[model samples]
Target: MPYFKPFKMIILGFDGVLGSVLSGALDLFSFTGVSWQRFSNESVEPRFNVQIASLGGGDIRCSNRLIMQAHCDIRDVTECDLLLVPTIGDSIDKVLKQNSELLPHLVRLANTKADIASNCSGAFFLAKAGLLDHKIATTHWAMPISLRQIFHWWTYKKISL
Candidate 1:
């Protein structure tokens, strides 16, 4: 098999989910590429090609009024070597009710062997696609009980954020 060069890291974003984790990872690593994407209402919006230009400057606001910014989109993700899903909110019920279309694409991406990483409540998306079944995972401590209650077959570990 031919070895492919590692290119950009793609960060998936919703309206409220922050993109800092993805951006920080890029800054910490010597990646040849990095980018982000917003998957809104069953459609994907490709943003700018990520350069050092997009970091340490802007702010993006989360649904909970948290501010964050300075991230690129998936169109900038060519030959993606890593993908990050940042923590969103605690309401899994609300996310499913609102972002139902997000899962099928997530499942498709996972099936294609994308290196999927999630933090905090981002696990909810994985769970929705049945990806967390029989796998060890972590989430915010306050929500583990509810997560376990909903995903009975999966083990949820409490982790400090």
Candidate 2:
């Protein structure tokens, strides 16, 4: 068998992360490989390899109260092509407080060669990690304007630069 490197994409898992977003993205990426070819009656290889990672490297509960056993933890992942942040379940402040420990891991991952992307409230984590500094970004539609102000206030120097 020929060994070809596939694009590695890691999805960040957290306590309040929406299960749908995580599973939805996982399923979408899963379909990209040879499975799509079989599903479509054509021959094609998957371009991406996906994995779900959490802080403790264990099962995580979503905002909808679903338990998801992550494939691994942030500590287990040395590097990847991309890191995807999913939607958060609660108020921005609450979620950020609950996930404060994730900042360092996210920061380390962001500093790597891997690209970082997020959906909805997930952008907060990326921003808190300093990945969004000086980058144009947006968050979940439901987020209030005040949240943006708070973020701007917190990272005033970085964003201004």
Candidate 3:
């Protein structure tokens, strides 16, 4: 069998983060190669090295009151293949304010070769970090206010997929 290097994936965890979204993203990435291999009766080899990170490697108090432990401190994470910002379950403004310290780390990661993505309203974080500047962005349809309206420097477009 050929050796495979697992893709490094980091999921940002924070207070007011949607519990379901956070866990779902972790499960989806973690089970990618293992699930298919198990069903195929092959050796189970996971494809991603997934970890949940918070500012200080502390426990995350989710919006629905679900508590999640972090795998590592966001500050200690210097590299990754992919970084995912999950949907915010609470008020966007509040979440942003509470997690303001993350913006610089987001910018630093964005400057790396890592692929950055967001689910639903998670785009707000990317936008707030100035990572979405000059890049077309979209958010959850239920988001009443547009990303462009909030971040004047962001280039947002409605995407149907």
Candidate 4:
């Protein structure tokens, strides 16, 4: 059999993140090529090397007050196949204000071969990074107006949760 390297997946971790969205994203990607193989009694060849990356490689305090540990520092991540930004559960303004440091990294990674994705209000990070400029983007249906108001340069498609 030919050797296969796992795809690197980095999930951005920060305070004010939604607990469910963060854990759900982690579970979904981490189990991609491993779980079903186990259930079918096949060889387990995991597909992704998933990691939760925070600003300082420290603990993350979710909006729900759950504390979670990050796998690495976001500043140290030079490359990845995919970078996920989970839903922001707290006040979007407050969260953005507190995690401003992530913007530059987002822009840097966006320039790489990484596919950047976000859930709900997390798209604000991508927008703030100037990635969505003149590009089509979307968010939770209820937030289209809010996002549009803040990011008038991009076109938004409303998606219902």
Candidate 5:
């Protein structure tokens, strides 16, 4: 294996985002080394440095009324190897408008060429930030029509089994 530093992942936690999604990403990434040892009988150092953040930090109230505590604000994040944008609830348009505060920070991070991933409604954030321009992106099934209507630069391909 190549010598490497831990990958820094800054997960953006926002108001009205699904609390489960944030926790799911955290739990999955936080214990990668432990999981490997447990399942593979080999010990290795953890590879990811994960931080859950918001626009201004503090409490992030979700659409389901679940409040998650963020470690810091996006402004405090100086370097990011990966940035995961969690989804807001049903109204991607409303959430995008209300959370415009995160745009500048996101744009700066994108300019750094960090890998950015968005979940469901979070794709709208990427689109609005122009991060998804000329990039392929997929959103929740219920919202793909709207996503396509608003952000035509990205090609969304639907697959059926």
Candidate 6:
């Protein structure tokens, strides 16, 4: 008898804000019985073996009241099998204009064979990273024009809640 290793789903956390939403979506789909892993800077009380990436200093306050002490950097995300990017309440204009700090890392990760998922405005991060070029993607309908204008090569589908 042979044993198979469990498939790991890595959720990228900037400040541990979208952890709940990403986790909840995964749960909703029952996605392959995935083991949700977070790549965060903060040291969270171990819920399920989260990998700390050492981002130097930052406060982590999730939307669902899960707080973490910052600990890791984006460079440490190489080992993740899958990547999930969730929305953050920051100035999208600035992030999109400046290409955001995490843009490069997300681009690099997307080049790999790993499955990538983004929720809400997280899709903006992916678009800025150039991952959505020639790909079909959906996002909250409110930003359709802006999104299409920014990433003209993509086919955008407006999603309504």
Once superposed on the true structure, which residue ranges of model 3 sit more than 4 Å away at CA? 158-161
lDDT of 5 by residue, 6-80 (tens): 889999988878888888889888887768766887656677889998977878888888888999889898879
lDDT of 2 by residue, 47-86 (tens): 7788999888888889899999988888878899989999
For model 5, how big is the CA root-mean-square deviation? Answer: 2.5
Candidate 4 TM-score to native? 0.93
lDDT of 6 at 127: 84
Provide the overall lDDT of each model, using Cα atoms, as 2-decimal numbers: 0.57, 0.81, 0.91, 0.90, 0.84, 0.60
Which 10 successive residues of model 4 have the least lDDT summed? 151-160
Comparing 4 and 5 by TM-score, which wins?
A: 4
Evaluate residue 31 in candidate 4 and report its C-alpha lDDT on the 0 to 100 scale. Answer: 96
lDDT value for candidate 3? Answer: 0.91
Residue pairs in collision within model 4: none
Q: Is candidate 2 or candidate 6 better by lDDT?
A: 2
The list of candidate 4 runs beyond 4 A from truth reads 1-3, 157-161
What is the overall TM-score of model 1 with all chains considered together? 0.60
Per-model C-alpha RMSD: 10.9, 4.3, 1.8, 2.1, 2.5, 7.8
- Candidate 6 off by > 4 Å: 1-3, 15-58, 61-67, 95-99, 152-161
**How far off is residue 83 in model 6, in Å?**
0.2
Q: 5 or 6, which is superior by TM-score?
A: 5
Residue 117's C-alpha lDDT in candidate 6?
79
